[model samples]
Target: MSNFKITDIVGVIPALITPFDENENFDEGRMRNVVDFLIEEGVHGFYLTGSTGEGFLMTPDERKKVVKVVVDQVNGRVPVIAHIGAISTKISIDLAKDAYETGVDAISSVPPFYWKFKDNNIFKYYEDLSGSTPLPMIVYNVPLAGLFGFDFIKRLSTIENVKGIKYTAYTHQDIHKAKAQIGKDFMVYSGADEMAVSGLFNEADGIIGSFYSMLADVYVDIYNNIKAGEFSKAQIKQKIAVDIIEASLKYDYYAVIKAAMKWMGFDGGYVRRPFNNLSSCEEEKVKDEFRKIRDRYGVEDIRVLKSI
Candidate 1:
């Protein structure tokens, strides 16, 4: 297994977006550029093939390939956690094993969804996947998948090799409570980009979110400011991030994220089928708004709104 400790799982990890070419195939060159850019910008780690990476839309083979590419590209510069969660328990186990073979630092999974599964079913899913690989398991507690409350999270924490969680809910209180009740050794990464400061204030070990792919430097600043107890500085950076996120929310979330990446010079291509790209007019509007924010905040080196 990887030498990744639970402590290594902390910081500004991007829920990395998978780049696709015009044909909608995985764009390996773009992917490598993204990996390099984020690392250079000072991100802590990478969480691959999660919701932001379109894991659910990708086939099992595609997901495996993406994990291998990222693992190889990362080359141990930072820890990589591959989100191998699939609808089927067996598929998740298979993906976990593949991720392990490819040298990912850890594996994470959203509880099996679609069909209404009871708590016991979810527990069994985690139990089976955790045993299939030696890598540490980070539970993806996304409330949209169905809220995993403290009791359930506490129970999951008890499982063998289940090291931490990617807590995506807006409830910052749960993060503080989890740290208090689940123990500080249990790593909790805040998955909301807009609440990076609030999450840190509540004692979340780190921040992970979809937007971090485009704005790693901003979140890294937020993390460092929080760690340095520079709350005011962190809040200033957080406000800039919130403005960007709120602007994106005006359009389809994933589509705008991909477009913004392109505007930033990364060009992550379009969101997959069932997720449409922004119209030409919509794209121009987004570009204009980002330009305004960049000038307003005197932001530079962010790669966004550099030129209108």
Candidate 2:
């Protein structure tokens, strides 16, 4: 077994959704249940408080609670990496330290997104974070919600404690360049659910995907088949996995993830404020599509299809 290496944490790492109660508070109990479910479903590890987890939406204390709950439930059974990025290094460092205190396997942080940071600022930010906590750190390189660009990754790689990165960008050149610069010791995780296979082929040690909780069996099967040299089955599994993502994208990304959680047994609910649930009209359409998947497997998925 690969223990605590960055590459060892690869494969089907679910960017878990933060469930909120109707009062718009995080449902900690439901969150624990969700972690248990993913562990049972065969996910490799957790990519907490990231894009899929709506990390930006929660308070620092609330986010820390999510990490603590997951680490407690997992209890050293699997790797649990908490996403610790914040609008400021103070907050990010706080979260990273908390993640260390909570017994998580590692901590990851996205570049500060307040303004377009210079390469030096970005480098200092990560180096500061990597130094702030004892836990291994993976830097997240994404400009969509921020200004840190490809050049930032190249520059940030200079930091010694910067363990690796989560590549969420769609550009293949960015992936190639990061791998080329970071070298084999620094792990690269595929952040796009739809590009897991391509990313894997392109040297993504594993995938950190939003869909892995509900669609985990498919990912596990795909990884297993591919490793077993069953390319045909792996391709078929990847196709189905992509089809599921295509369907989920029809609704809001996070909403559909929560919907999928309910469809399974985890009871993950709608996203908190500023990010709403799937519209009633869209929910029906999603239900029908989910049913198609469930009917084939003969499994009742409450995390994905709650009412049924």
Candidate 3:
């Protein structure tokens, strides 16, 4: 059985961006660097192969490789929650087993999407997948998938080993209600990057989002400030984060994130195919905007941008 309790997965957990090579291949070396960089920046845990990681774009084997590399690199320094959600129960089960063997602290899955499965079917999916491995199970409640509701979450929570929910919707009210109804033992990580401050104030156990991968220290500060009752300080950081996100949203989200990381001196390569890449001119514009945001917000000067 997994030694990690639900509480161990709390705090600023980044839904990591999967690094790729020019040929769109998974780059192990770059992946390790991303992992090490985030750990050094003080993130509490990692959620691998999720939407931000382009989990659905890669083959199952590629996903497994990514998880193995991260788990090996992490070396138990912090908890690693592998996103093994697939449309098929068998596939998710297989991935969960592999995640257990690879030593992840927990496993999470987006309820099977693409088909309009009923609540019962969804519950069955969680039941089989969570029971397949001893690792703590975190249900990914992404409303965009159209399968999420508080009632569904409560039902899933009853499953053996199902311990938490990565609540990715914008409804902070649901987060507050879940905490009150589900009890503190059920971990509810706020998965909306733009709402980090609101989520925490509403009683989310922690924050997990795509932006956290790019701005780990900033979000870490936000979490710390809130915990310390420094609401004003946390709001300042959250505003900076919002500004960055607004700028990036003007371009292809994944492409611009990779581009920004490159400008920061960490070349995470490009977003994989089926996702558009930023043109040369577009890349430069994004770089300029990002630099301005960084300077305006006084984002820490640890990156190579200071020298540039």
Q: Against the hidden reference, what TM-scores do the models get?
A: 0.96, 0.88, 0.94
**lDDT of all predictions:** 0.88, 0.77, 0.86
Clashes of 1: 0
Candidate 3: residue 213 lDDT (0-100): 71
- The list of candidate 2 runs beyond 4 A from truth reads 1-3, 146-152, 173-181, 291-308
Candidate 1: give the clashing pairs.
none
What shift in Å separates residue 261 of candidate 1 from its native position after superposition?
Answer: 2.2
TM-score-based ranking = 1, 3, 2
**Candidate 3, residues 56-152: lDDT per residue as tens digits?**
9998899999999998898888898999999999989999999899989999999899999988899999999988988889998887677477787
* lDDT (tens digit, per residue) of candidate 2 on 125-177: 88999998677788886656553467767677777777778887677566666
Error of 2 at 221 (Å): 1.8
lDDT of 1 by residue, 80-103 (tens): 999999989989999999999999
The lDDT-based order of candidates, best leading, equals 1, 3, 2
